[model samples]
Target: MTFTTRFAPSPTGPLHLGHAYSALLAYDMARAANGVFHLRIDDIDQSRARPEWEAQIFDDLSWLGLSWPSPVLRQSDRVPRYRDALKTLWDQGLLYPCSCSRADIRAAASAPQEGAPLHGPDGLVYPGTCRPASPPSGPMPDAVMRLDMARALARLTHPLCFHETGAGPDGTTGEIHPLDMLQTVGDVVLARRDMGASYHLSVVIDDADQAITHVIRGRDLFDATQIHVLLQRLLNQPTPAYHHHRLIRDDTGKRLAKRDDARAIATYRAEGCTQADIRMKIGL
Candidate 1:
């Protein structure tokens, strides 16, 4: 099969150095291999996503001399596809409604190191308080729907693994594997019974639809790959080769964030920073 890769970014915030690094790395890999590089806007979080941010994403990528094939895929326009997969998981008995509040989860997790804490890009790990007590016959909760991790794990055969294709710090190729989905990542959300879809669900569907054969992204999401792998298995989707690259950090050595607007690609452009400057800063 021809090599295919993608860079997916949410439109809730401006692209930053981190976004530039990921986009450039994927772009270079595709260019070097004479492969296809695609772009997708992860605009499923309708609450925070805005038109201006989406426009900025396109502007920023263009400024950096990157281009995706055809019209870009937008998640907001693909809710039906995500919903279909979600219903499939729910029908398979792999998903359950969650009713626990933040306070409730805190109280449950306070019992000490037992269940893995659930988290998202924002950072507070969710405690699976209702996972055990979840109702079988009621309507799904209004808050969230979580995957049944134990049930999902029971179906796996060999341990899961993914290979990193790009060159590394030690000049070695990297492969990650022997992943245990239950212990490390735990039961993650598939949707807010309130929201349209979760990141894991939407991403797998989109990647498959886009025919993405390789996933090139930051190392920070390496742990989350287990969750995506599990979803791929449950949904009977192909698991692509994954390249988790190094993250871009600040002077303090902390990973850059969307909230760090000072590093936003728009800011850099405003200050007349050249595409070459971004390329050099990210070591592309």
Candidate 2:
């Protein structure tokens, strides 16, 4: 397969130093191997996405010396596709509608039950609030849809693994066992009521549809990879080789956010910083 990867970002705010690092790095790697690099607009949450921010994403990346294939894939235009995948999972007894409110989850997670922290990140087994004992019967519901983690894992007959060119946060490399997933990441939201598809589901579908051979992103998303791998198996999609790189942080050692306007690529450009300066700032 060709060396294919992508840099997907939401147009919710300015592209910060972290975004620069990721996009530039992906672009560089793609060029190095004579591979393909794609720019995908991760506007799954349309509520916060803006045209100005999307425009700036193009401007900032171009200023940083990067170009991508035209007619970029935008999540807003792909809800129907996401819904199709959701329906497939729903029919396979792998998805169920979720109706638990934030308050309900917080209340349950705060008070430990069944010797498992249902809502706790590290101990997240599942809340099972809206998860039916058996897959609900009917056309797919118009509510939040969550994957049944255990059921999804059960469907995977083979041992799951991914090529880890970059290390995970805890230095985890490959060969993720089923227990690890069951112990940590629980029944995650695959399709949200408002967004139509959650990050995990949309990303899995997008990567597959794009024929992405490798997934390169920050280590913060390492844990989420487990969810993706499981979904890939359930959906019969190929799991791309993953490289979870280190994050770009501010002087305070906190991961850069869009709110950090001082670290925004546009701010640096306005201050007369060159593309190399941006690369150097992000330690490319």
Candidate 3:
């Protein structure tokens, strides 16, 4: 099979060292394997996504010596696709409307007898406050849609796993188990009340739609891969091989954020930093 990878970044902020490292790594891997590398703009969060930031992403990646095909995939343009995926899950009795707010979820997860709340890739684990016995008559505008993990898992006859060429956050490699996923990632949201799709839902759908074969990205998303695999299985989509690279951290050892303007690629370029300098800084 042709090796296919992607560097998907949200336009909520400018490209930082971390973003550079990931994009370059994915590009290098694709080239090494004589594969295709794609660039996807994850601008689903319309409230935070800015056109200027999106343009900067193109400039930064091009400056780093990268090129992708025309008509790049953008999440904002794929809402209808996500809706179709949600409809499939709903029809299969795998999804339900979640009416609880963040505060409501936090309180429920923290309630007594729940022990310490299980934290997953999407922040505090959902307490399943809104999972229903059956699908609703129709989509509710005000309700976030969540996957019923237990029911979804039960639908699968065989065990779920993914091939990992790179290490996880804990330095784990090889096949990953879905057991930990069940314990940690509880009832993840597929579609938000405001936004049509959540990161987990859109990412899996996008990867499948793009026919992505190898998912090379930061190790920060290693845990989230569990959720992605589950979604892929539930949707009957093909799973791709994964390579989770180490993250680039700041001098203080914290993961770089978009707000860290000092570390932004544009800022570095303005300061007379060369493309080689970026590669060396990111240890390419």
CA shift of 184, model 2, Å: 0.9
> In every candidate, how many clashes are there?
1, 0, 0
Q: Against the true structure, candidate 2 has what lDDT? A: 0.87
Query: lDDT rank, highest first?
Result: 3, 2, 1
> Which TM-score value belongs to model 2?
0.96
Per-residue lDDT of model 1, residues 203-278, tens digit only: 8899889988999998777666667776787788888888878889999999999999999988988999999998
Task: Provide TM-scores for the models.
Answer: 0.88, 0.96, 0.96
Give every collision pair in model 1: 118-126
Model 3 C-alpha lDDT per residue in residues 1-284, reported as the tens digit of each score? 89999999999988999999999999999999999999999999999999999999999999999999779999999999998988888888888877788899889999998989988898898887887776666654446888888888888787878999999989987555656666788888889866899999999999999999999988999988988988898889999999999999988899999999999999999999999999999999
TM-score of 1: 0.88
The segments of candidate 2 whose C-alpha lies over 4 angstroms from its true place after superposition are 112-125
Report clash pairs, candidate 3: none
**What is candidate 2's lDDT per residue for 118-234, written digit by digit as tens?**
432323445677777887788988998888888888887899888889998889896788876765777888888899999988999999999999899998888788778888988
